[model samples]
Target: MDPRSEELAALNALGMLESDEKRVLDGSSLVDRELRDLNAELELVAAELGRLVVPVEPPADMKRRIRAKIRSRGGSKLRSISPLALIAGVGWAAAVALALASIWLWRERASLNQQFNSLREAIAPVTQPTAEKEEKEKPPARNLEEELKKLRGDFESQKTALNTEIEALRKREADANAKVAQLVQEAQAQKERDAAMKLHVATLQSEIWEYRRSVMTIVWDASKDQGALMLDKMPRVESGRDYQLWIIDPQKPDPVSGGVLAVDDKGTAKTTFKSTEDVGDAVKFIVSVEKKGGVPKKEGEVVLKEP
Candidate 1:
C-alpha cells in the first residue's frame, strides 16, 4: 500500500523499471505480501488491456512522422561522433542503451502487453543528449575556432596554388633570358666573321753560313703590324738561346719584337706574331738568335734580315 511500492509495481508491470530497480521491487515483494499481490494484479491488468485492444494498422508514413516529431522535440543522433563529445555524452549513455534494451523487449513481449508501449512512448521525449546536439550547444569560442580552422585551410591551399604559378612564370622568364643571350652571342660572332683582312708578304734572305740554306718568309699586315712567319731548313739555336723575330719601320730607329719561335728537328717552324710596339709601314722583318726567353730590345745576333 506504500506509494513508492505501488509506483515500482506499476513500472515493473510495464517493463519500464531498470534491472537494479526491478531487483529492489522483487526483494520488497518477498517481505511484503501486499506489494507482491499488487505487482501480480498489475501484471494481469496489463495483459488484459493488451488482449482487449484490437491492433490498429499503422499508416505508411507513421515511422517518418514519428521520427520528425522526435527531431522537433530535440532527439539526438549518434552517428559519426567526435571523441570529446562522446566523452561528454556519458550521462545519457544509459538512457540510449536502455532504449535499445526496451526495443528488444518490445519485439519479444509485444504480444503479451500493448499498453506498456504507451508508457515507453511517454518517456521517449526525455533523455536525448547525444553528442551531435551537445556540439551545437557548445560555447561561441568553440565555433570561432572552427571558423578559423576553415579559413587557415583555404589560405594554405591558395598560397600553394600561387607559388606553383609563380614558379612556372620564373621558368619561362629564365628560358627567355637564355634565348636572348644566345641570339646576342650569335650576332657578335657574325660581325667578326664579316670583317676583312689586309696582309703584306716578303721573303727574307740570310748570308750567314748557318742560315744560307735556311728560308724565312714574312706575311705582314702593315696596318696592324701583326702577321704570320714561316721558316724552312732553319738551323736550331745554340744552347741557352731562342730564335726571335722583329718588325722594322723606315721612320723608327729601334725594331719591334715579333715574338719567339720553336723549331722541329727537320729545321722547320711556323708561327703567328704581333709586334710589342706599333710598326707603321713595316719595310723589314728580321730573325735573331738570343739568350733563352727573348729580350725586350734587339740584344742578340741577327741571323736574317728582310731585303
Candidate 2:
C-alpha cells in the first residue's frame, strides 16, 4: 500500500526493474487489482510500440566528435573523462533523442484519431434522416467512403517513405563498420613495418677501411646478417675475374662468402650482401679478386681488408 510501490510497478511495466527488485515486488503481494491492470495496459502499449518503431543507428562521427570536443576543452576536464564513460554518455544521448521522436509520433497519431472521430460525427446526421422534404432539398451528401479511402492511401504512402529511410540508415551503418575495420588492419601493418625498421637500425655497425689507392666503406647489421660494401677508385680487374666479399667470424675456421660484386667503369662500386653462414661475431671483412664466380676459400688476391 506504499506510494513507492506504485512507482516501482510502473518501472516494472516498462521492463526496467532489476531482478532483485522484481522478486521483492512479487513476494510482497501488495500490488492491488487496479495496479495490476495498469501494468498490463502499459505492457500492451509497449508491445504495440515495439512493432511500430524502426531501429535507428547513431551518426558515424558521433563518438569521434564527442572525443574531439572533450580534447579541445583540455586540462583537468579532459583527464576526468574516461573513454568508457564518454561512450556511455553518447549512448544515453541517442536513447533520449529516440524517445523524443517516439513521443512526437504518438502525439501525431492521437491527433489523427481525434480528427477521424470528428469526421465521423459530422457525417452521422446525414445518415439519420430528418424530415424527408429537408433531406431531399439538402443536395447529395458528400461520399464519406471515398474520403476514408483517400485517408488510408495517404497513411500507406507515409509508411512506405519511413521504411525506405530506415533501409538507407542500415546500409550506412554497415559501410561505416567496414571502413573502421580496414583502418585497423592498415594500422597493424604499419606498426609491424616500423618495428622491423627500428630493429635494423638498432643492430647496425659501420667501419671504414682504407688501403693504398682504394678506400672501402662497410656498413653491416648482425641481426639481419647483411651488409653493404662501397669501393672508391679501385682499378678494374682482369676479364675473367670479379670482386668477392668475405665475412670472418672468429668462431669459424673459414670466412663466410658474402655475395660476388661488380664495379662500374668509374672504378666506383656499391653493392649489398647477405652472409651464407652465421656472422654474429664477425671480427673482420675482406674483399678479394677471384674468378667470375667467387670461391669458398681465400684463393684470390686481397683487394681490401678491414680491421
Each prediction's TM-score versus the true structure: 0.36, 0.33
Q: Write one digit per residue (lDDT tens) for candidate 2, span 1-307.
A: 3344565567877889776556544533322445556666767876777877788988999999998987888787755664445455555655665576557656755676676567657867778735874465333223334544565576567556655655565566577678889999999998776456322211111232433555555556566787665665667778999888888788888878987888889777767778897766445787788889888787887767653
lDDT of 1 by residue, 207-258 (tens): 8997886767666766666876667778877889998888877788888788
Candidate 2: where are CA atoms >4 Å away? 1-211
| lDDT against the true structure, each candidate | 0.71, 0.63
TM-score of 1: 0.36
Native-referenced Cα lDDT, model 2: 0.63
Best by TM-score: 1
- The ten-residue window of minimal lDDT in model 2 covers 197-206
TM-score result, candidate 2: 0.33
Q: In candidate 1, how many Å is residue 137 off?
A: 99
